[model samples]
Target chain A: MAKRSFLIPGVDKRLLIKDSLKAMPDFTRRRFIAGGASLGALTLLTGCDVVDSSSAETLLAQVSKFNDAVQAFIFNPDALAPTFPESAITKPFPFNAYYDLDDAPDIDGKDWKLEVRGLVDNKKSWTLDELYKLPQVNQITRHICVEGWSAIGSWTGTPLRDFLKLIGADTRAKYVWFQCADKDGYNSPLDMRSALHPQTQMTFKYASEILPRAYGFPMKIRVPTKLGFKNPKYVVSMEVTNDYKGGYWEDQGYNSFSGS
Target chain B: MASLTVTDEQVGVTPAKVIQPVWVRVMHWINALAMILMILSGWQIYNASPLFGFRFPREYALGGWLGGGLLWHFAAMWLLMINGLAYLVTGFATGRFRKKLLPITPSGVLHDVRAALTFKLGHDDLTVYNYVQRLLYAGIIVVGVLIVLSGLGMWKPVQLYYLVMLFGDYPTARYVHFFCMAAICAFLVIHVLLALLVPKSLRAMIIGR
Candidate 1:
């Protein structure tokens, strides 16, 4: 049913737009001003009337893609994010995520399996104990947040590059996408180069202790070379793929390849 | 470069010199607009995680929100870098920097500072820059370059670790970037006041006389 048209049958479209504009004082002032700029640029660039907020957002979204390319271009696979000494580690490293500390997924290691999918030859899902049996390396590195805060924490895990190699993942795949256990199904795509970075890890422990609930129990992808969000937490599965599947934040305008 | 000068026939006397060329005028306005957008959006970004306790009044900010602020900031970043680079390259290529901002001695700068404080500094020849003006312009240019470099260092700290090291660290680079922005803001206020104080110079920039 045409519910909106039923209230005011055969309403003049132009008058409807005009009256709506009059009602939206804040939108007319703030969004219109900002939206008008991108509208102008978009009109020039695309040669069409993309006359709404979504279209303007589209223009900005394109810039994020451009940033992804630039980030990838500038990214040095061999250049490591600097490691800190034990003394330099921030005391009580801050727990951060889209959700509150209480809401972190209650994961049982016995039931939780690290599912390997996509191009990896080894599709076996490893239990927490099995995954922990692999070689572990530790590094004290800064976790830089998108909001401009940073903290140093020591993480211990199997190097993702070595892990991927062991799993017989296709090295030429463009992305290693992670699926998390968060309620929102939080996920992220890690670029192949960054995925293969020496420091990238399938982290199992933080500060010599089993990963806490606040810090993603069972697993988290530790990507020191990237912003915090890129390091997916409570990671349940990882797919080695050539496709470009956007992440929760990346889909919402955060740069895809937000590598430092 | 071909100069845009009024011939003696047009003025019916001596040919007039072009104080600001067309390219310089275009680049100046573009840089000014770009810097304004950058600073305003940057303030919004700063408010996300403030260095100081106080926030910039919201009305002065450009973007409506953090995401919007970032979009505006990143968009203007390209404009500022490209235009600033062109300005510097063109300035050096034409010896404009040397001609307009040279001979800045400690005594000369001191003399101009005294003259400026006493309101005795003359703006008779709009073509010529006083020692104070010269220093301010040169200082701002350096600040502009540093801000871009520091921004790059922050943007890719891991990739550009060498550059970050030169500035001490990531946090220091951020502080340097903020201070450079403050310097630019200060220069803008003084530059605008001086322009309004001497309208002919402003007209020279606009019309390129």
Candidate 2:
């Protein structure tokens, strides 16, 4: 039998012993030991030992993965984020991004083409007008930012699920990655569940007006259920793939599935 | 020890009763630690995007960044919820909730408030809880439950739509969560101060009298 040392050093052993009278079940202990072993394996899998910061990053990433699994398991596809009336729309919706508004890329809408790649059957690129011709839907939903503030905005666009169906996308793929035209290569990946959400749209208009450059001019993926960063803006290309392609902020330690 | 004796003399009493059971003492300390960690880390998470105009000072918040803060918050959240549930169940099973924590009357509360305001409040009995103590404890427990529900609403707004709707909306739920946290913090301040002022009461909770 392996010696188990779950308690941290310098903790009050008397209290712990007293508390452990309400013992956990045997299966829970076994599962926890297995989890701990996998955590060690994860550290090794990242090709780093405990001495390096990479090990810590790997552990954080593993925890994030666990979080993603828990969230996905609990997610209800049919459920929707609460919608608000137009009267509840926040006026002067705040513009937020890694770059300043003035530095937002000014792309020629007519010249832009949305390149499609990976497991989709139809690999034809899409023009903005071509996308606008798809069945459109409007929703007034709250845009929650990780930074703590939220604003309600009216958005209109084709649902990404509908678009994926049009492109004959392999809907069972694990990830849907987006490549954005924003500076510093701002991009994000979405889980298949979120990608298929009815509210997940390839947004063209905001607040009944064509999306301003500050809000992703050509197009934005409006995912109301996810935190703001997960909804990548100015998207130029999309790939449906089984491979794990880490995102810009995700590589920096933000959880890949940052659902609020 | 000497101060205790002097205080006993001043109050004309002797402390010998077992005021807190071992379970109560254990649960109390665990809850205290869990709440402290949760508040500190919650502040760190809140600083990521502050509700108000300004952010909490970075030094006061726990967990270095948004990621670290979330980790701490989630871990402590489980600790708090589970331990809190155990405490409640054990408290009821042992009749402690009925004998010590319950039966708070509005008039008794008013009397205790007046006594406190008039500086006539007594701490002669370490084995029994005063009306104010009972009321505050009951109020904090309710607030703790609200905090947990509101937290769930914020964490899974879609799955827990009814909970979110109870608070009006998602942003409003966040605000309510913050407000409940502040209320618990305020209760903690008063609780700690009262414990210090009546040192024997603190000792009773620690060593079970």
Among all candidates shown, the one with the greatest DockQ:
2
Task: Give the native contact fraction of candidate 2.
Answer: 0.36
How high is the lDDT of residue B162 in model 2?
94
lDDT of 2 by residue, B26-74 (tens): 8898798889978998999999888888888898786578877776576
DockQ (model 1, Cα): 0.15
Model 1, range B1-209, lDDT digits (tens) per residue? 11223223344543357788867998998888889979998988887778778888887775667667777677678778888999999999999999999978999999999999999999888789999999998899889999999888887888888888889877888889889999999899999998999898999999877
Instruction: Report fnat for all candidates as fractions from 0 to 1.
Output: 0.37, 0.36
State interface RMSD in Å for all models: 17.8, 10.6
DockQ, every prediction? 0.15, 0.21
Off by over 4 Å in 1: A1-56, B1-15
Write the residue-wise lDDT of candidate 2 on A200-247 in tens digits: 999999987889998898899999888889988899999999988989
* Local distance difference test, candidate 1: 0.83
